[model samples]
Structures are given as C-alpha cells and as structure tokens.
Target chain A: MTVVDIPPPLPVRDRTALHERAPGALSPMLTRLAEERATGVLVREHGTLHLAEGRVVHAESPLAPGLDVLLTARGTLDAAAWPWTDDIPAATHRLLVAGLLPRGALELCRLGALYDAGYFALAPSSTPGRFRYGTTAAAGPPGAVRPLRAVPVTALERETLRRRELLHRIWPDPSADGAPLIRADPVAPPPVTPRQRAVLDRVDGVRTAPQIARELGRPAFHTLVDVRRLAAAGLLVPRNTVPPPPPLPPVTDPDIALLKRLRDALEAL
Target chain B: MPGIDECLLEAMRLPGARGAALVDWTSGLALGTVGEAPGGDHETTAAEAAELARLAAEHGAFSTADDTEVTPPVEDLIVSNRDSYHLLRFVVTSFDATVFLHLWLAREDGNLALARIRLGEMAERLVLG
Candidate 1:
C-alpha cells in the first residue's frame, strides 16, 4: 500500500520570506491549505492580494478611502471580517474568481489583522479547527476592530512603549482625571498680595494646606482659610472622588402581566 | 524611506511649509507636530484633525455597501486653503494603533507628488516597535 504524506504549513516560511523582501518590492505570503496545497497572500503597506490553490483569492488596495478604519469606526464589523468567516472566505473566493474585490477596497489594517490572526490561529498551535483559514467565511456578530500593527510579535513590547509615547503627544493625560502629573500653576496674583501667591505656590500635587502650614510653621486653621479662598476663586482644583451611580427602582408597569400572557400564548402557538 | 518623524520634517522642508503633526486615529491625539505657531495650540490642532478623521471615517462606513461588515479605515486626509494645503496620512502598523501624519503646506510652493511620496516612505519607516 502506498502512503500519502501531508505537507507542512507555509506561513512560517512565508513570514520570513515576506520580511526579507526588498522594501519596495512586492511581497507574497505563502500559507498551506487544508488539502495540503501551497497558497499565498501578497501583502503591502497599502494593499493585499490573497491566493489559494494557485489562484487569486482576494485583492485589495488603499487608493482612496481605506477600508479598515471605515468598518470599525462605524461599529459594523467584528472579527467576522477575519479571513475564515463561514460565508466570507467562499464569498471572497468567488469574488476573486469573478474579479469583484480585485484591487478592491480593503481596510488594509483590518485585512492585516485578519490575516495575522487567521494565520497565527491556524498555524500549528494548541487550538486547531477553531478558525481555519482557506474555508468559507460567515457573517460575524457586530463588534469593533481590534488594533493591528505591522511590527512582528517580538517587537510588540517596544512598539507599545513607542505607541504610548506617541499617544502622550496628543492626550498628555490618558487617565480619567485628565490632569497631567505636574498640575498647572495658579494664575499670578497681584504683586502686593503675598498671602494669595503663597497659597497658590503651595497648592502643588504633593502637599495639602495642612502640610504646607506645618512646613511654614503657621496655624493650620488660618492656612485652611487661605486654601479655601483660593480654591473658590477658580485658581485651584482639589482632587475629588467620582460620584456613585444612582439607584433604579423595580419595574411595575401595569401591562406586564398582559405582555407575559401574550408572550406565553405566542410560545404555545 | 524615512520614518514618520522624518517624513514630517521633509514635509516642512517643502517650499511654504507651515506646520505638521502626527495623530492617533483611535483617540485623535497628535503623535508629533511641526510649523504652525500662530495657528493654535498643538493639542487643539490635533483634536481638530482627529475630529476630521472621525467624520470622514463615519461617512465612509455609512456609504459602503458592506455597511453590515465594512468600516472605512482612514489612510489619508487632505484640506486646502487659499494659500496652503493640509495633509493627513494614516499608518496602521502591526501594534493595532492607527497613526496619521499631519502636514500643512503652501499651495503655491508645495509639490503634492513629492509630499505624498515622502509621506509614503515615512509611513513605511515608522517604527511602531
């Protein structure tokens, strides 16, 4: 009896090859199909084209409005757009065969994420058959597009650091407090008012009025008065805890019983 | 190809360059900024650019046929004035962040093609890691 040997996967090789491709050159990412055949997905910064069983599976480009941010921003697609949704893979296969999504609008980032997630999910991990690529795609439930970057996993931590740096450039305060580590200085009081200026200067993130008064060797109550006055003048902001959510009463609609009866009858029918 | 930072500088080197900034799409924050001192604060500019990106992205998703499954990922945004043009180029790197480079240029002195080419190169060089 003759034995048929199955071929190993191609994503690992394809990833290395794609990484080695010249910066400006077109890159093709090869992956193995369930039938043990070679397949590929050509990837670029702005576009992607997928091939299966020696045929084009899909093609996408970002000439105008890109597609990734579109679907997610509108909250239209979730991972359903992944490479192996039940109806989608087949739909895309047919579309590719028929030339529908050729140079089609692909939210490139989403495409990238789907490809990465699908490729990693199927390529000989603990879980198998969960989300197989090269299969029919199905419509997924509504969800948001998770973030996907081009950097490899090895560099993810460093990438996160840099991403945070970039994020801070815009919103210096990522927290709910919306305040920087170093609080803003109070507005300058008139030169004659040393008392107000002293109060303003002591109102840093660190010490409270009591602490400041203790350090200055002054009476706590007098310092508290000054602090309160400055705070009232809109020159200072003290930390405050977030308020709790209000309570809700139980529902007591008079039509509830009637609705329940109607529902029970519909179920019985 | 230079990284996103270098790309903004190259953009600023353009003949009537005004200012530039890079923004994150998710939060609408500027990653970096250049040029426009008198225009406004960087935070304000970044916030405004983010708003534009959000509007454009929403519009694209609404207009798409796959509204059920498709959303527009913004690649670039452009605005023109009597004397200048503002360009926003988005780069979706592997880390799941959407970053955009904002460039402002004088229409009369700027070369659109060169600016675009430079931006593309910069996007490729941007080291998300």
Candidate 2:
C-alpha cells in the first residue's frame, strides 16, 4: 500500500468559553483551523467537517443526509448497488469510473452537502461539543466521506448566515423549522405556491422539516424555508397542534414508493 | 458541466458586468460569486436578489397561462435602476427550479439584450451537480 503523509493533529482546545461566547462557536474553531492551515476533521455534536489545507472539503450531519444519500434518494444511484465503505477516495473514484455521477456533478453535490450540513453543524444549538483535529481517514464514521474541493470557511459561514436570514424573512417562527408538517383544513386552506404545495403533500403530520427534506432529496435549508413559508401562509397545521413524533426509522423497502411519489411530485411542482 | 466558479467567471466576462453569483433562490445561498457586488457585499446582494426571484417565481400573475407545471413560471426577470441592471436568469435542475444566476451590470457598459442571451446560453450549459 502507498503511504500518505498525514499532518500532525492540532492540540485540543477546551472551547467551552467559545461555545458560551456564541451560539455557534464552531465557526471560530473552523476559522482558527483555516488560519493555521490545519488539515483534519473537526468533530462536533451535530456532524463532522473535513478540512484539507485550511479549506472545508466535506461535512456530514445527522440533521442532513450526505451526498450519497442525496444522490440515491433522488434515484440517481441504485440503493442496492451503493458502495458503502470507509475508504471515501476510493469509493469516489469507483463511482466516477462506473459513470454513476459525473465529476462536475459530484463536486457540485459535495459542495451542496457541505453547506447543507454546515447549516446544522454550526447551528447555535449545537453547542458543548469538543473539537479534535485529526485525519478523518481513520476516525470518521463508516460511511462518512470527503469532497473533491475544499471550500473556504468564510464562504460557508456567509452562506449559513444567509440561509438563516432567508428563513427568518419568510417567517419569524423557529418552531416551524423542526415541527412535523400537517396540511391545514381544506375548507380554508391558504393559497400556497407550487413548491409549498409539493411540500404540503408530503406532510404526513409525522415527518419534520428535515426529515421531509431528506425524503425529497432536497437540502434541509430549502425544506425549512418552504415549511416556514407554508406556516406563515397559514397553509400548514399550527406547530402547537401537532406533537412531534418519535424518531423515524431508516427509510426501508415500503418507503421507496412513497419517496418516488414525493420525487415525482417535487419534479412536477 | 462547468462548476459555479467557472460559470460566474464566464458571466463576468460579459460586457459591463459588475458582479455575478449562482444563488439558490429557495435558501438565498450564493453557491459562488465573482467580480464586484453592487453594494460591495455579495452576501446581502444575493439575499436581496433571492427575494425578487422568489416573488417572480411564486406569484401566479407573473406566470404564463399555459405554464401550469413549471416551478418557476417565469423564465427571467430584469430589474433596472438608474445606473445598473440586475438580471436574474432561472436555471432548471433535476430538482425544483430553486437556483438562478444573478448578474449585476453597469448600465453604461452593459448590453441588456446580449447579456440576457448570454445568460440563457450559460444557464443551458451550466450544471450543478
């Protein structure tokens, strides 16, 4: 096997104060790592961001699915044939060779995943997490992977702030961000935009905004914006009326048809 | 299959181009940016432009009668001020019509018709993975 030179891990910082100083201290930690040109993974409570030469190459969060899931969720890649492995680079190469995804498209999806996951990873509520700078090659979860290009940390921060503001502009309620979507009464349903209608159809009153986004294979932020807009328009069930359900099980065979329908509805919208 | 950076760079090469960005209208995120922003801040400009894009894409009056299925019923929107022109060209992807290429152009040096044509071409070739 060919050996690769891995950079030394940066010393661990307590960062408790940073977390207290701001809701999302991960930005500062990321900024520091970028400034130092550190190359490693910054693990946090929500997810992990892989940094290479001071730039963020990839990010993964439980709140947002990874690129693989996004691709497969959209039926771009066959779920059964997905190559699951710890070796990301090799897997990426294999996918390229197999024509599963074009190089440019893969990169775009990677970037999209980075920002999508970054929104939740750097959320103010994802606090009290530790930061360890070490190569993720040996540390990331079994399926966690890195991207081909490393995006500047500043760009990611700016995009995150923009998304937050966009959602706020649509509706001021943060509760709508995580609440399960339920269609309002048909008798007096507020007029909804096409996209909002598409989202409303998937509102089983059980799946939260994030879960709906995963099912639709769209970015979580996009789903949040739609949900917030729908709530603002009074087209969705009031947040207080619906109690959040227990965590959902992974999408299984029975759900594929539902996901396909969601996908078709989204495309039609 | 040009990346956002390359697409923005190509957009900037247009006549009188002041700034360009690939914005996700749904989330108001700038996938990439190039040149100078109208207000000297790309982030704010992107968000503001997204508001316009959202309005055009969502309002029924702006859509054609025959376009019952397209997410963004309108093809493009142009907002011109005293000195600059803001062009929002919608790009359809595998998913919803949530992304657009925003171009801020100087009125004196910009050619609106040509810019629109070029933006359309770029949008056709532009690929977001």
Interface RMSD over true interface Cα atoms for each candidate: 20.9, 3.2
Candidate 2 residue-wise lDDT, B1-129, digit = tens: 465677789999999999998887777777778999888988788878888898999888898878665458788999999999999999866533378889999999999999999998887666533
Alpha carbon RMSD to native, model 2: 15.3
lDDT string, candidate 2, A1-269, tens digits: 98998989998876786668654434776778878988787877777777777877677788886766777775766777668875544555567556566554555566677799988887875366556676644223234233355678877877777677767777887887777667776567667777777688899878888888887887787778778877877777545664568897766776897988899999999
Record all residue pairs in model 2 with backbone atoms less than 3 Å apart, i.e. clashing. A105-B129
Off by over 4 Å in 1: A1-269, B1-4, B61-72
Where is model 1 chain A poorest over a 10-residue stretch in terms of lDDT?
A145-154
Q: What's the true lDDT of residue B44 in model 1?
A: 66
Fnat of model 2, as a fraction = 0.29
DockQ of 1: 0.03
Q: State the lDDT of candidate 1 residue by residue for A1-269, as single tens digits.
A: 98988888664545555546532122122222212443444444434434444333333433211233333333333435533432433443342333222211222333433332222122222322221244311212212321111222212222223334443453343331112111344567422123445556766666665455444433232244345445444455555445457787654776986798799999999
TM-score of each model, in listed order: 0.32, 0.76
- Specify the CAPRI tier of model 2: acceptable
